[model samples]
Target: MTTDAVFDSPAVPGVPLPAFVQTLLWAGWPMEFLERAQERYGDVFHIHTLLFGKEVVLAHPEDVKEVFTGDPDQLRAGEANQPLEPLVGPRSVLLLDGPEHLRQRRLLLPPFHGERMLKYAAVMRETTAEDLARWPRGAVFSLHPHMQRVTLDIILRTIFGAEDPRDLTDLRAALSKVLDRLGSAFSTIATIPPLRFHLGGFSPWAIFQREMAAADKLVYARIAKRRAEGPREDVLSLLLSATDEEGKPLTDPELRDELMTLLVAGHETTATMLCWAFDLILSHPAVRDRLVEEVTGAEDPQRLPYLDAVLKEVLRMRPVIPAVGRRLSAPLTLRGRHYPTGTLLVPSSYLVHHNPEVYPDPKVFRPERFLDRKSDPYTFFPFGGGVRRCLGMAFAQFEMKVVLAEVFGRVKLKKARPGPAKVTVRVFTFAPEKGVEVVLEG
Candidate 1:
């Protein structure tokens, strides 16, 4: 409990498997591993894995607070996220550290803020409405892909400023292909370093590079056009006009990396969260009735408190990104255990959310808990915390609320199958298995 007491404690208990075996298990069922480890080792443990060498898992709120609130100098998040470099690019904010990270974050923060976010809300509602209008009523269908399409449309329109019909179509097609390939191949490349090697065009890494190049071509073209034409309402235009403290403009490659980061992170996680929300709401009919009533009665659904609670509960029960990783840049003490500089400290969001000390009856799907009490950031963070907290947290949360309100208010829906939906791994996100099958009701 106290850092002094844990300072001399042994390194967190864990399985001592070879890196390859650990990688195999982690890729398949990381949540299961974390759950079992917590049950066996209490709140703190370790997983000696190749993904990031010796990774320690922390679940206690106190430990989480230390990790989130720790000095940026002592904990290097960018180095911890090195595996993501290939996908997000070297200049991505996700892969930057220290002063450079702060710079990129400041430059990117404006477009996702107040007035600009209001404009994006309009896009979110319109895009969701357009997508939902095409769904076959009174028929069972997988909801994940539907949610993905809507979120992708919103991102394309707001982030890339893809207004031309041809440009939108071409970029969407190219990005979709790239995403599909990445979804399948990223886990392998991320877990196994050797597999990331490029062996000509037929190799998976080579194929991924080709797909990214195709997507990049469209992105760079848009960047050039936006530069030539001047500023617009989209994020790309805003970034094009932005200048640092020294008045230095972002370069082409810098713009590409930032745009790619936004494109991928902006849509995918929101889509997964939406799918899980649908699955959770439909699984509990009473909750669904109350949510629908709240959404329908409110002139502005985003103002409905119960609806907000439901969203919070969904995120708590099943965070899209279950853990946030950090590597120690200096010797540090957590839960009384001293960790070396290279130690990989992963704060497990899934375990912390489920901790009974934090939430009584944690397994139960109860939104009222949120209504009754607020949770501290360290205990309930789904978007992570500290300087490395997700930059689009506000944007993602607003989009989910708007989209859910639009969908639930307009249509009656039910789960296609009985019992709780199975959870599965999709890329790095925990998704509702079977794509959260649901039937529309008249």
Candidate 2:
């Protein structure tokens, strides 16, 4: 899918900074950098950077629609996600394109089907309740780590079918180490060419390698045990029985990669987004009160429109991942303009969600907007869009509702620092800066 053919540079305005400088800004403070670029260059802009190359960022909903619905063959999302390959491995659905990607996606889709969430709901609710009961009452604490613990436990039990306490503890510790390191601020250095080297065990790169190896050992062990024991309800069991068109089951390496993909992608993103939910919900008393009222005595919080709307608004206001990208392998027309092969075309979810035209008073925390109208796919895609959209989207949202219900129904939380939310840049995600500090009000 590569060629030596040359094409002219994109016709859009570009970020007026050195490539390295732009790389640093984009890597370190992506939302801030993107907002500044949008303000300066309008909705359509380009930035040439060392890390991601020439990226054409599209923020207008129409433009976003074009990229989202564009041909996946020509718009190779897998290529655009190379930085993630080291973490999720090459066989990961996140790093596959065209036919390979489709096969893997189909195999992975069954476990995350909307109806399947009902089976997993019990695990989610139980995990959330148990985690919340341990939170320090009437004292300020970082809710992010606690949320992480809850979500990780849910992922372990519901997704991995991890029932053994010994295995759970080992897997949890290993996986947490890997994610904590990968999601840390300094993790960005490992992505840069000049800065990405190992200086023995203490080096960031070396330490990540060690943690990943530890996690992989536990994951592979689980896969083997599941293979021997036969099918159960969890995602791993379903995947173990899954096969490609040729009727071949996924190999050990493939299973390892996909499991790692689910853990790394699902764990932190869901936890961090949950943190944003509390940050937003507590900041807006009316919204919080209405949400609590809706979830308090409800038989199923998932069916509560207001609770669903609250999560929807939280995703809209603070998307965990700022953008989804596709590297063009053939010339493609977007927003009435054509981008050549090798151009990384990105649909900025943060920018589109914040667009005043699409969302009036976009900065306001208003779940009622969703209650009034259905969200347009292109305008509100926190889980991304098109065929390559996140497969775990439904599961994550369902899990969020269960956890939120447990929180709002059982306890009242007030933000320790009541103000606008501050975003911290992990390597690839947007998280609460101070972990969304909060206190339980009796």
Model 1 weakest 10-residue run by lDDT: 1-10
Structure candidate 1, residue pairs in collision: 6-336, 6-337, 7-336
lDDT (Cα, 0-100) at 157 in candidate 2? 96
Assess candidate 2 and give its lDDT: 0.85
Tell me the deviation in Å of residue 146 in model 2: 0.7
Model 1 agreement with the true structure over 200-289: per-residue lDDT tens digits: 566777777788898999989999998898888899999988889999888999999998899777777999899989988998999999
Off by over 4 Å in 1: 1-9, 17-21, 50-52, 190-192
Misplaced by over 4 Å in model 2 are: 1-10, 27-29, 49-51, 191-202
Number of backbone collisions per candidate, in order?
A: 3, 0
Deviation (Å) of 429 in candidate 1: 1.5
Cα displacement (Å) at residue 316, model 1: 0.5
Candidate 1 lDDT score at position 170: 94
